[model samples]
Target: MTTTTTTSDHADDPHLIGPFAIVPKQDCTHLADHDYTLPASAKRVDGHQPPCTDCDAIRENWVCLEQNCSQVGCSRYQQKHMLAHHQNTGHNICLSLSDHSVYCYGCESYIDSPKLVQLNRQLVEASN
Candidate 1:
């Protein structure tokens, strides 16, 4: 894992409210279509499941914007993004990219990785 945090574009946006920032109005459940299902070659090498067994957010192969690190897993991408937020926001704590958990173990209820976009949409919808 890259411990080298960037003060670059990955830094906190003054616009966001919490550690878990939403992309605003982007639908989480239905991301832009990718034609067919993800091929076996597209799977994460990390052994952790992608698309989230819980939310079913990623059903296709959407590559990460970051070159060479093109992870297609919605949960993995979200977790990595949130991990950066958690690191920068003074909420520094145990975060596992492998486990993709923001909270401590034995806890019930979690903010679903894919639902963050839906939450953003709701906020957008509510404000309008």
Candidate 2:
């Protein structure tokens, strides 16, 4: 009696697997070795901004040091409470100069004096 063994018998054969089949397994190792550095387009450092004291309690969009409402229509304008409200409402507080003084009307806080001039300058330059 003769028995026939078909290719299906060796279907699990490692040698039969093509390069494409093995490519995905290598991806993890490649990713492990990868530096994952920021892109060149991200080379420019962000300009200095005041730190949020209540960042732990705030969300990303609403983060601000000023306690004023960053929202345009909202009546609440107190700096500390506004920061909390802004965090809750997902509003971005404006941080810019007004009447030759650096202030964020939205957050209702003054920026650091050292950075205030530079920030105003940047705004002025951008407007031109």
Candidate 3:
């Protein structure tokens, strides 16, 4: 199936910017068929399907979830949208389908931080 993005970038130098640079792409296989509720954040989707927070359009709004929105009071908070990892935080483990989202491990954009694996191992050891 062909992957179509619902977002784009406006650049005067169109040749300098590639389509991939702004395309809100996602691996549909990992996406839930229906919209799911995120009670903790209280972000709701009016669309038939919950928007893929990582790369799909939500309702009629299209945003790039690849990184946390840098806009002040953009509605998407830094804790939810930013993927900048810390040793204290194992991963940007966003289970939300709104605000901040992530790609599946198999997806090309997935971040496989060495820190995440190390943290997981530590957790296992502590539990054991």
Candidate 4:
């Protein structure tokens, strides 16, 4: 399993507190109709820490939440490939493969969803 460490730069942001980013709200317009379901084609091709599609860094990777897109990319703190994916495809939501934390680039914040958490839990369990 991959581990996440909080950096000093994130200390100033109240919403990014703790070992992980804080979920300010539970509602996200982009996920308002989302079912938090992974596509049938989705699989951990590279185990828990998949290499970013745009780069070799895998420590801070994330998977796109868009149903048809299973693209993985390093986090903004690394290569920003996931952000680039969002910019290029307008697919704003992603789940951190490191911690299964849901984030919406459109909302620019962490999002809370029990269903999503459960789904990620299942994914993790299956992988083990």
Candidate 5:
């Protein structure tokens, strides 16, 4: 995905030097038959934000969206725990906890589809 960086409003914050927005792919083949809701067997976290299962990071976290797997992990920019999860389990897709963005590791891009939009909305509501 192509990313464009611009200055952030919070100039005083070192981590907020700029905002990074990823230009997502229009669709993903893997999500063609995805069930938009979390599986019944999926365990829900108690709070709105949960830490990564592998590293306990609260920021830039992602939840695996393969089958009944809901494993949370730190983003690639942090510890790459999600990448490691994909490598070990072959679970391709994940949803970002911070922004509700959907990503497909197999496709190597963020996905932006009608179904994904619905799914992201469902997740946001579920989290709340």
Candidate 6:
């Protein structure tokens, strides 16, 4: 029996987060018929998911200017403009795009991807 998997198949799968999924990479063709199960340890934990630590720090240090918004905005709506307004008011919950690290003055949550870091820098600068 042959089974084919695609990104869409894992779109709603709890084990799938961000861009990674169980589908075979374009270069690999041998495992097309098998269902791959990610290890339990790889599954994300409830509430223990990755934290935007920088955002948390920012909230701790600064108060939001928008009456209805927090550092990341409301649970129902998140707007960058609102977040920028908060930052402009001295909330420092910005993350480094180059590495997905949060900059909390001298304290940082380092996310090692250079591309993400660069992207984050661009976003912060643009917002400013």
**What TM-score, over all chains together, does every model reach?**
0.19, 0.23, 0.23, 0.72, 0.69, 0.18
Cα lDDT of model 5 by residue, 45-119, tens digit: 565457788888777888887766878888999999989999999888888877777889988888777766557
Write the number of the candidate with greater TM-score, choosing between 1 and 4.
Answer: 4
Expressed as tens digits, the lDDT of each residue in 1-128 for candidate 3 is 99765335345533234554533333334333333322322234453334434444343222222233211111134333223221123222233233233333224343323323433353345336
Please state the error at residue 118 of candidate 1 in Å: 16
- The local distance difference test score of each candidate is 0.34, 0.33, 0.32, 0.76, 0.73, 0.32
Error of 1 at 52 (Å): 22
**Candidate 1 at residue 75, lDDT?**
36
Please, what are the lDDT tens digits per residue for candidate 2 over residues 4-84?
866666678543344322211211211222222221211112432222333321221222222332222212332354345
Which parts of model 1 have CA positions greater than 4 angstroms off? 1-15, 27-36, 46-128
Residue-wise C-alpha lDDT for candidate 4, range 56-81, written one tens digit per residue: 67687888988778798899899899
Which residue pairs of candidate 1 clash? none
Model 3 sits at a Cα RMSD from the real structure of: 14.9
lDDT of 1 by residue, 27-120 (tens): 2232223322223323444443345323444432232322123233333345444334333442322222243322311221232344334433
**Top-lDDT candidate index:** 4
Identify the leading candidate in terms of TM-score.
4
Error of 1 at 50 (Å): 12
Q: Give the poorly placed runs of model 4, Cα more than 4 Å off.
A: 1-21, 39-48, 114-118
Task: Rank candidates by TM-score, best first.
Answer: 4, 5, 2, 3, 1, 6
- Model 6 TM-score is 0.18
lDDT of 4: 0.76
